[model samples]
Target: MSDPRVAEHMPLLSKKWDTDVAKKFIASKEQRWARDGLGHWAFLVDGRYVGWGGFQKEGDEWDFGLVLRPDAFGLGLRITREAIEFAIADDRIPFVTFLLPPSRKNLSALQRLGARHFGEVNYDGARFLRYRLETR
Candidate 1:
């Protein structure tokens, strides 16, 4: 979260991520993933961490999420595609959802991946556009 490029897009998380805070946040997510079998993973390229991609349950839907550093921008589409394909192949995941802020101007890219806008939601005092992707 300290990465300026990454923090620029994540307004909510940017302000509070010191070492302890970040560690706790990661631990909480890891715990949730371990217990629910739904969570994201670090995106690595040749052993270098570039970003993260994974799922989180939100209102009975498994929401897919992705985040990449500015230097890794071009790799986002490919990584997202692979993550979607993985989700599709997992029979347990009926569909995937997404909650993106307006600042995330990747609607076209998401559309290309078969995500359709479902609605909007107010989460944690912030608004997000919701989307869904199901097996074709």
Candidate 2:
């Protein structure tokens, strides 16, 4: 999350990485898993951690998020397809919503995955383009 290229599309990342912050972030994701029965997962390549993201409950909707290291950006679509396939088989998720920063210019991958841009939204003081994909 400290990569400028990555942060460019993340509006809410306001702090630098630190041991405490890492612990807190991991704790939060674990808490979400315990509370929601599912949460983000770490992705690895060649036995090395590359990124982390998954479904997060926002109100009554399940929002999907996928963040990868700059070097691992090319794996996004493959990871997304796998994640969506999981969503399709899971009854809890009927649809998935994506909130992407307006700075993101290439969203064709999402469109290719059957996600459609329906509108925009203001989330935690950041404006984002909203996309929806039916998981059913």
Candidate 3:
């Protein structure tokens, strides 16, 4: 996204948001779907694009992530719950990992959802706090 606020805590996002970057991002998500049978999703509310996020297989674990617009921030927990429910139904996803930026202070919602802090991880040179939630 071009919005700096959206990228503030996102580490893998190295490039500035532009037409080329947006296209590549979409293409990459599509590639994931083709190869892994699952990938990111575009989330909408009231017929409007709110944000996009979903599952991506990493190594032997399935990671879950969500990035919502600033205006839709309040809906994060609800959206995440719905996504996790989807994971629960899918036999392939035994667990879901969440990598949150350390800058995020209010993580009570994730804990309320039964997610436990796994540890810290360095992803593409970016440090993040990892959390795991078992779907089974």
Candidate 4:
């Protein structure tokens, strides 16, 4: 997608997140995952920008984040899973972390994806449930 479109639609899709926390994340690029040579990719379905999923360094470990439009939730996960596989194939990131909110809805999905909760931390005023992806 064009940068202009991405810039324009980001706020709209972020609204679907329905939380100020996610909105804050969308507003700041620095907070989202970005790394040299291996960065986050925006997920576009049917030509519309839906969300982003990617990896970045987090305190000695590589962490991943996925933010998707509510309407595109199902497909977003599908694409994100593919992105994770690609990241694994690169071999630069031996493990991936996901910082999720301590909510049943979020925990259930992470558990289904094989993410194991190993710790917790307070970041940006929100307490996050930390999950790690073990690589073979």
Candidate 5:
């Protein structure tokens, strides 16, 4: 998503159950994040927007995040994996991390992508498990 459009979708993308807080974070920072040509991209399938996934700076490392419309959740993981691969192509990104809330469903999907738990962090009153996909 481009800057203004992403900002406009922030609330809808932030829906707790249907989406994820990470989506909202991206939307909120759309302008600053996209200036570098590295930021969230809305995932489109069959010409419809399924969700978004891409690269963003997190702490000291480049991390990735994604979320899909509730109806598109299952297929969304595939899109996320592809996005991760794209992000890894950039030499600036040594490792890409996924921060997931403690949900069995999400954890299972993440594992299927070969992501390994690397750490955890508490943010926005929620705890997130950090999974890393090494690019080196």
Candidate 6:
């Protein structure tokens, strides 16, 4: 996760990373991915890590997202499509929510995936638009 290029798109992350901090972040993600197969997974292309996408569950809410490098922006819609498909395939996931900053408004993509705007939320001092897609 130390790749600065990839972190450019994450709106909530405001600080730069040091070596130790980066290692800890990676370790934390590894632990989560190992625990439930629900944490973020690296988006790789031709063996290169271009971005990441996955879900995180908090109580009954499942928040999901995909962050990709600037050069990989074109892949965003495709990733969104796949994420929706993944959610529909898993019966355990009753629904999936997406959190995005006000600046990154891409509601059309959500509409295309049948996601409805749930509302807005403030997290870590930043406001985000929340959208949800239900499988049932």
TM-score each candidate: 0.91, 0.96, 0.97, 0.68, 0.72, 0.84
Residue pair clashes in candidate 5: none
- Give residue 102's lDDT in candidate 4 (0 to 100): 56
Which pairs of residues have clashing backbones in candidate 3? none
Who is ahead in lDDT, 3 or 6? Answer: 3
Candidate 4 lDDT over residue span 9-125, tens digit each: 232333333467555755565544333455566778789998776776766777787766666667745785787687678777777888776542445666776889888878766
Candidate 2 lDDT by residue in tens digits, 22-115: 8998999999999999899999888988899999998888899999999999999998999999999999999999999999999999999999
Is candidate 1 or 3 superior in lDDT?
3
**Number of the predicted model whose TM-score against the real structure is largest:** 3
Say which prediction, candidate 3 or candidate 6, comes out ahead on TM-score: 3
Q: Candidate 6 — what's its lDDT?
A: 0.78
lDDT of 6 by residue, 80-121 (tens): 778778888987688999888877645697888888999998
Tens digit of lDDT per residue, candidate 1, span 1-136?
6777777666467456698997888998899788778788999998989988688877677888788877888998899888888888988789888888878885898898878999998878878898988864
Give the per-residue Cα lDDT of candidate 3 at 129.
97
- Model 5, 39-106: lDDT tens per residue? 77878899999876677787677778775676776885789778767766878888888777664344
- Name the TM-score of candidate 1: 0.91
Candidate 5 versus the native: TM-score? 0.72
List the global CA lDDT of all models: 0.82, 0.92, 0.92, 0.66, 0.69, 0.78
lDDT of 1 at 15: 59
lDDT of 3 by residue, 1-136 (tens): 6677788878788988889999999999999999899999989999999899999998989999899888888989999999999999999999999999998889999999999999999998889999999999
Give the least accurate 10-residue stretch of model 1, judged by summed lDDT.
8-17
